[model samples]
Target chain A: MLRIPCPYCGVRDQSEFDYGGDATVNYPALDASEQEWFEAVYLRDDPKGPHTELWRHARGCRMWIIVERNTVTHEITGARPANPAHAEVLKRDFELETT
Target chain B: MGRYSAWEIIKQGLTGNKGWERAWRDPEPKARYDAIVVGGGGHGLATAYYLAKEHGIRNVAVLEKGWLGGGNAGRNTTIVRSNYMIPGNTEFYEFSLKIWENLSQDLNYNVMMSQRGQIVLFHSPAGRDAAARRLNIMRLNGIDGELLDREQVMKMVPHLDYSENARFHILGAAYQPRAGTARHDAVNWGFARAADQLGVDIIQNCEVTGFLHDATGAAIGVQTTRGEIRAGKIGVAVAGHSNRVAQMAGVGRLPIEAHALQAFVSEAVKPHLDYVIAFGGIGHFYISQSDKGGMVYGGDLDMYNNYAQRGMLPVVHDVHECVMQVMPSLGRARLLRSWGGIMDMSMDGSPIIDKSPVEGLYLNCGWCYGGFKATPASGFCFAHLIAKDEPHPAGAGLRLDRFRHGAMIDEKGAGATAWHH
Candidate 1:
């Protein structure tokens, strides 16, 4: 079973989760041609290596998550919300709590 | 005594009554049993029932952690077929199909075993070749199977948008006439009641903690939530949680991983699909329109192993994309609901029904979403192994060492491409 990390319920068994395939698909613009729209929606590149896929927490919190997984080893490297693109790099001050 | 009909028993089994709840709250078995089968799903209960009905072993007990059929059996899409690619698998599953035919009458329950036919579409030439090999094997094994052209398939499933412009190009398919989906919970309840009537004790909400062993390294009894109970033999029919149960027995250390598989249903609409369809190029998206006028579908599992219930959006989207491609009109159908269930995926994508090194301990696991189809045959084979202390001819080659000996019966060729295929 996949170790799916639910944003609300933390981590749980894959039995309680659903899988979403390739996460890089983008909808075509409104002004695009019919062929372009078809290509955008129907075409897909099923990668065999480390790919960012989509997942849902069916049993726990109902949140959409983007899971970066190695399809070969069934190892999940990272996870985040279903963001289409990365945010701009920003500089931030690091705070450390030394307890 | 008011004789309860099969429907009444099924209703009580699915929607537990007040008595059912009270009995489950404090379940206590008889003083002793000749055999104890863990996991009161289809296989466990079927084994218990068959042992009492066929083998005359009435002193049997079926232990369930939760309600009957609440596990994978309830969660399965309930597609039953024996059109396997190998002779051994094909023969075994064909036997299961026969049992499925007479199952309703035998159990005195209305299982609704619909033989609406099942077809697997192939998009690529490689897939076509593989399907051809499987079809040939099925035919050789005396199974009712055939290869249909694209036109034939389109005529059979009229709503299928098989135009060349479809997302996945129109291709021929392998059709099996005997394969069909059935009511999942009814089968479980039918077997449960049959076993109950045959003097097999059914215990619900009884979680098995560990196994009690004798000095000779033999499993004497089980440690459960209620108390200790001895048995002459034991069969572990727990599919998804096989590894956990095997670990308790100190055996079954293979490259088996527990994965969560998901299924979704669309809102009830006019019935469109009449047959079960499978897409080979896609992620094994096998689907069928249910009796409720909703498309009941499921696909391969998520890539990781975790006990989380909810699935990711990408899987749902991809699965919907495939469905929409086959029948573009369904693109507007709203998804009614989705659910997930655990599957014990072996490295070879096959099951292991063999006696372990542990004496008196037997295993029938690693089903990988195919357990629902093999319930009857699996139960029969396991019970035979336990009763006669030998493997049945149908399940003789399904040994644990087949993986080590390089004699794997990789039906989907999962061994050749463990990562991708």
Candidate 2:
């Protein structure tokens, strides 16, 4: 079983969290085109290596956390809040370091 | 390939079984061919066979990165069914069922296709109504499907938990009498041998690294680990690696994700389970007793996009919980082994058998968890498209651009999410 680290509630069992899919998506404006919205909703990347995904602490503190994990190895590299303030900083740092 | 018959078996018995030849030959990769299949699994081998037998294209090569049937072809739970409700899928799967009916004779090999039947249990009124609608659609399509009431389900599978206080109490089920399991490895071997006999080269341990395109940007060949080989046409049936292979040909992202789907088997015991049974309640658990008496079963995907051919323990626990809830007696059966296959979950939960944007390049992928059952029709239709440059009637609706045009064939009505399907 995976032990995911929730930013608000420390590390916990994977069953306590509900998967929320890719965390890299940026929702378009309310008046964005249908194509843009469709791409944003449906055209998500499925990379083979490390990925950042959203996981909700359903059975715990009820906070959305961005968990940086490896899809192939299932390794937890980092975790932080999915709140915009912290999420943007983490994502940018991840992209910069990886690139 | 030598003809396999009872007479041959008797003759071999008399000769101490020494006259048997190898099922297929391990041939060296040629420098060029009329057509090349980029995966030596069941679909690619069958595509090569039909391309030679029906399309009169004898010079074909099937390149595999590993040994034949080493991928998802031999990794699935092996349950075969045609109980789909959608228009395109129902006809296509029914056509596959028909092909499977005579597959052994057609390929001159015993595929061991069993038709014990399949029962999908529904636990609630809403579930029953939805199953009724799906069954009506099946009946309309001339495919067999019967709605079984509580007593009928109890009669069919008496071992199931039927107590009034049981979790997810049994309400009814949809039964498909012609649905069953097949010997997955035998299917792959049979197709490879038949295709080899029809003058197709079956090259193993050869991986395609890149594509060869002409000035017009049409794919004409591939660069493999062995070497570069030219072909008139190239068909990619690389299952979970569909997006990876497509990238080599300059075809970017696809509406597909590779997720690990795990299956478990219990230790062999006295025969008890006679039919393939699936739960339609909260969790996605399906179980069937193998011919060897082992209970082969599986549940939902691991709910992550990973190309690794392995899954997590959470899904394993989820499956065990569901199985124990349905059949309490199975709680005593110890699990012997567990394995996972990379499923190419498409956005619409249906397959994509169409021509790639690059000319002369054909694709047969996005099979999700249903590829094993659709092997025959997937090959037949893909070969037709590669040969004629047009979609086969059975696969006409499975276009790659469906997502862009909002023509998605979402069978489970799960919208566009890959893992939900």
Candidate 3:
């Protein structure tokens, strides 16, 4: 099991959190073109090396955090709060009520 | 290669059995070839076989980073079925199933294709409705499908949990009598031997490190660990490593992800489970009994994007719980072994058999968890694409541009996510 170090709850088991997908994707503007929105949402990257992804502390503090880890090695390099600026955009686009 | 037959076996047994030759030749890599297939799994070997047999292209090379069939070709649970629902997927997989029906005779090797049947059990009303829709589509396409009631399912599989106090009540199931399993290793060996006899070089341990591209950005050959080998055309049948291999030719990202899907086998017991059974509720759990009496089964993907060939404990735990919930009598079965195979999960859950953006480079990938069953058709269609410079009718819908064109063949109606599919 991956011991993810949540920014809020410290290190915890992987089962305690829900895997939110790629964090590097920046939500497009509300009035952006459909193609742009599709690219932003569907055309996500599957990087082989270190990647920044979202992880929700579902069984812990109930906060979303960005965790930078190597996908190949499954090593967590860093953790931080999710981009606060994209909170509303994520909520609207991803149907995520919590950030 | 020596032909395998009952008479030949008897003669060899009587004469000290020293005349058996290796299934394939281990030859040094040549300077060049007419075409080069990058992966030596079942698909690649079958591609070479068809390229020689059907297309009359005998000068081919199949390069493998390791031994043939060591990848997912030998790692899957060996379930074969064509009960797909979508247009593109349904036709293509049915073609594959047809090919598999005659594969042993065509290759002159016994693959042990068994049509024991399969059942996908449903718990909720919505799930049953979805299964009914899929069965309707299958029947319309000439594929056999039967909706079995709870009592019928109980008669089919008496060991299934049927108690009134069960958490997920078994409502009904979608049964496909033609679906079954094949001997996985025999398939690899058969294809390799046939391709070798047709003069296709089966080169193992020859890892392609980079691509040899011309000034116009067309892949002309590959630089491998055994040295550089040029080819007029290149076909990549690498499953999970498709994205990494494409990067060697300067192709950008792919709509594929590599995630580990693990399989498990239990200690051999008495012959019990006769049919391949699958759970269609929450977790993706499927089980079947091997010929040796071992219970071979697997669950969902590890739920992470990684190339690791081993999975974590949570999936194991989840699979165990589901298996016990379904077949409570098997709770005492001892676990023997488990291994993972990296799946090339596509954005739309369907496979891609198309020419790459780079000229002279063909791609056959994004098989997800269905590669084993699609081996023959994937090879036949991919060989057609690589040889004729056009997609075969059976696989025409699996275009690399489908994701951009919004023509995605979303088999499970799961949008865009690799693991969800």
Candidate 4:
């Protein structure tokens, strides 16, 4: 099982989380063209190497996080909170714990 | 090899079994062909066979990166069923069922197609009602279906949990006596040998690197590891690595995500489970005893986008949990082997056997985890599409733009979640 290091809940088994899908997608405007909406929502590059994706700690802290992982080897390298403020808080906590 | 028959088998046994030639030739890749099919798995080989047999396009070549049946062909649990309810999916799968009925005879090979039957257990009355609705539709479509009560189900499958205090008590089941399993490897080689007999080339170790397109923006050929090969038409049936091949062909992003689905086979046991069974509650799990006595089974996908032909440990727990939940008697059965197959999950939980945007580039992908059972019809319909340049009636609904058109065949309403189905 994958040991995802959630920024809030630390490392946890993958069963404790849920997949959220491609984090690299940039949703078009609410009034965007139908084609744009279709492309953004349905189409996927589905690369063979490292890509940023989303995962939710559904059973842990229930926080959505961005994860950097490889699709080929499934090697997780880093992760951070989805929200900028939460990421700042996580960085501060790491610095304080180290000091 | 000559015609395979009971007489030939007995004669071969007497003649020291030296009469049989190679099942298929390992011919080198030709410089050109009338049509080229990528991926020599069950679907690809079947497509090549139909192209030669049905369409009379004998100048065909099937290119395989590895040996035949090396991919999902040998990885699946070999469960074949056509219990779909959706309109677009129902006809296509039933057509596949029709093909499976006569596959062994049609191919002149003993595919070992077994019609032992399959049952989907329902735990609650409401679940039974839902299953009843689906069975009603199947009957309406002229397909065989039966709604068995708890008593009948217990008599048929006595090992299921029937106690009143059971966590998920068995109420009844929806069964299709025609649904069963087939030998996966035989399906591949049978199609390969049959296609070869019809004068189609079965080329292995020929990896397609890129597509060669004309200035008019039509695909003319492919650049492969064996060298450049030309073709009047190109069809791709590489299910797992379809998106990668599409990228190399410059088809842009497909509505597919690669995910690994794990399957397991336990050590041989006594022949008890005659019918394939699906767990009704909780996680996705199904099991059926193979002819060799091993219990072939599997659960849901690993719930992530992955190209690795391996799975995580959590699904091991998830599958075993359901196994013990439904059949607690086999708690001590040791797992013999486990493996994974990368599935090309589309936006909708269906397949896409249609023409690509580019001319001469036919796309036969998006079979998802259900491709194993759809092998026969998928190849036939794909062959039709490639030859006629129009979607076959049975496969007309499996278009690439169905999601954009808001016409998804989303059974169980899993929506866009890749792993949910």
Candidate 5:
């Protein structure tokens, strides 16, 4: 089972969470064309390195979270609520761990 | 209820001789086979039969430790869909869908292949986006997948819980017109008969004890519970027991998890479910009513990893509750039976069909719960690999080395939830 680290509820089984795709996907501007909209949603780098993705704790307290995971080993190096400060802390932790 | 003795069903249906023995109780394995296929499930028998019929490789033996198809093949909820996102997987599964289209005619057996259509419901905007992207990709790959609107989805199944307060109100669904279900047993029996007719020995009770390696450290034969069977080529079609079998060949650990996936059947009713109902938000619960009027349904893999065939009470309770929530009419229906099967969930939640690092030992497994759907194509592709000593174009990326080479074809982006396939 996918072990998702719920930012609010701590680590839990993936059965409790719904996977949101790449975390960097921002809603396009109101006048965006179909091509740009498609690129924003459909196109992804999907690199084989560290990736920041979104996950929702559906079965628990419904909250979207950012999970920094390794595509190779499937290890969650860091995770936090989809908040700026939380993301900053995660980024710092990741940097410290990598270095 | 879905509880009927196999004897009662087969008593007057059809039969001259009760074909295919339960070989687990018998002894004596034959030596010198033209082809020795491991894992005597539907795929193994189908491959053996196809080899004799299509390629004329007649001297074959299907080695099985237990009753044929008693593994994941028998335990799967019998869903067949070729609606894939990736080009390679989509193309390969389309070929399998073709075989499924004419399978009953080709096998001359009643597989009960019902193209009743399968609807995958999306509850959230993210889910809808994913479904739309998948539909677009499927269309690009020449597959008939459509994004159905709320009205269309309601028209297909009116009894679904569409009220706004429900979990994530059903946004819409991705429907595949051709995707359907089949009788799992018929698939196994059909292949077994065909293989038996074409001089392929069905060796049951023959557990592979160890791999017999040549002087150059290549697999030349396998020592079985009965005896040693030497063959020019060997195919491991085992699914859940993939890691154990791979170890016998001195292969590295597979990036696969063994998880128990459970399925339940409800009491017979005046068939309420017309098509397969799969919820993307509701724990991957896919339910379809069988021809017998029993609700044959399944939920996600059990949270823990174990080989236990029995399921926990909470999982069954959750499934029953979820099924009730999906179709309120099924609330009073009694769950007649529930069972679990070990799934060989690959790291990418896709199958692996590769010539292993060990020479002469080929793999055709990691199918998770998709063995029944890919039976014909798996046999076709795996036979090609074993016969030609190379990967078929369809199964090229399925190589075991793809993990090391950084080329993974994850059908579902369950890369993190990979273990739950």
Candidate 6:
């Protein structure tokens, strides 16, 4: 089982979390071309190595986070909150704790 | 190497059984061929077999990184069914079922196909109504399906958890009488031996590293670990490694994801279950007993995007819970072994058998979890595409541009969530 370290809920089993796929998907404009919407909605760069994806701590804090993990080995490198504002808060809180 | 008949079997048995020959030839990778099939799994071997047998493209080569059936061909729970409800999938799966029906006779090899039937349980009235509609569609398509009530289900297959206080008690089931199991390795070997006998080279340890493209960026051949081998046409039917091979042809992102699906087998016991059981009420779980008495079963994908041919502990626990919920008697059954296979999960949980964007390249992948059942038709249609450069009638709906046209064959109707399907 994957041991994910949620930004709010230190660490927990993967069973407590839910997998959100491909974090790199950039949804196109509503009035975009059908081709652009098709590519964004369907196509994926499902790599063999490291993949940056989304995970939700559904059973714990219920916060979404971005995790960089290897798709082949299931080795997790790091994770941060999905919201940039929450990530900024984490950085600031860490700085305050250290200082 | 020769025809396997009753007379031959008896003669061999009487003569002390010393005249058996190797099933297929181990040939070196040739420099060129009429068609090159990358991946020697069941689909690829079947493609080569059909290419030679049907299309008369005998000068073919099936390149495998390892032994012929080393991949997903031997990794699946050998259940076969054709109960699809959609237009695109309905015809394709039914065509595959017909092929499976005649496969043993056509190949002169015993595939051990047992049509014991498959029962998919439904929980509530609404679920039963939906399943009834699906079965109605299937019947209209000339596929056999029966709606079995709780009493009929119990009578057909007993020992299920049908207690009064049980959560999500079995209301009824959609039973397809013709759906059953086959020997996985036998399917692979049957296709390989048949293809090899038709003058197709079955080359092992030939890893395709990249593609050879012409001036117009059209794929013409492949750069393998052994050497550069060219072909007039290239058909790739690699299941888990579809994207990696497509990348070799410089075909960028695909509408697919590689996820690991795990299967488990229980320690051998007295045969109790004769039919394949599918229960999606609690969690995705399907199970059937092998002839050796081991209960072969598997559940949903690890529910993550990983290519490792191994599963995590959580799915094991989850699957065990579902198993107990479905069949409480199996609570004491010990797990014999568990293995994983990387699945090519298409965005809409359907397979694609169409020409790749690159010239002279044909793709036969995005099987998701339905690869095993669709092997025959996947091969036949892929061979049709590679040989005639046109989509086969059964596979005509399976196209690379379906999503662009908003024509996704979403079987589960789950929209974008792939594993849900």
> Whose lDDT is greatest here?
6
> Which residue pairs collide, candidate 2?
none
lDDT of 5: 0.77
Q: Write the per-residue lDDT of candidate 1 for residues A3-96, one digit (tens) a residue.
A: 7776567788776776655577666779988655544443234333576777766666655678887654567888876652321111122231
* Clashes (N, CA, C under 3 Å) per candidate: 44, 0, 0, 0, 0, 0
* Per-residue lDDT of candidate 6, residues B154-204 (tens digit): 998889999997878899999999999999999999999999999999999
Worst 10 residues of 5 chain A by lDDT: A39-48
How far off is each candidate at the interface, as Cα RMSD in Å? 14.4, 1.8, 2.2, 1.5, 12.0, 1.2
Error at A83, model 6, angstroms: 4.6
What's every prediction's RMSD, in angstroms? 12.4, 3.9, 2.2, 3.2, 9.8, 3.2
Q: Write the per-residue lDDT of candidate 3 for residues B1-421, one digit (tens) a residue.
A: 6788999999999999999988889999999999999999999999999999989999999999999989999999999999999889999999999999999999999999999999999999998999999999999999999999899999989989899877789999999999999999999999999999999999999999999988888889999999999999999999988888887777766888788999999999998999999998677899999999999999988877777788888899999999988888899989999999999988888899999889999999999999999999999999999999998899998898888778889888865543363
TM (chain A) per model: 0.74, 0.82, 0.83, 0.81, 0.74, 0.82
Docking class of 2: acceptable
List candidate 3 stretches off by more than 4 Å.
Answer: A30-39, A42-45, A88-99, B415-421
Q: Candidate order by lDDT, highest to lowest?
A: 6, 3, 4, 2, 5, 1
Supply the global lDDT for candidate 6.
Answer: 0.90
Q: Candidate 2 chain A: worst 10 consecutive residues by lDDT? A: A90-99
Q: Score the docking of each candidate (DockQ).
A: 0.03, 0.46, 0.48, 0.66, 0.04, 0.68
Write the residue-wise lDDT of candidate 2 on A38-88 in tens digits. 777666677778989988788997667889988889899999878574455
Q: State the lDDT of candidate 4 residue by residue for B1-421, as single tens digits.
A: 6979999999999999988899888888889999999999999999999999999999999999988888999889998889889988998999999999999999999888999999999988888998899999998988889999999999999987788767888889999999999999999989999999999999998899999999988999999999999999999999999999998897877989888999999999999798999876556889999999999999998878899988899999989988888888788999999999999898777899988888899999988879989999999999999999988898898988887888888977655643343
Query: Please, what are the lDDT tens digits per residue for candidate 5 over residues B229-345?
Result: 899888888887787688768865666656678998988889688898898765668899999999999887664434556665557767877786788778888888888887776
The TM-score of predicted model 1 comes to 0.77
- Pairs in steric clash, model 5: none
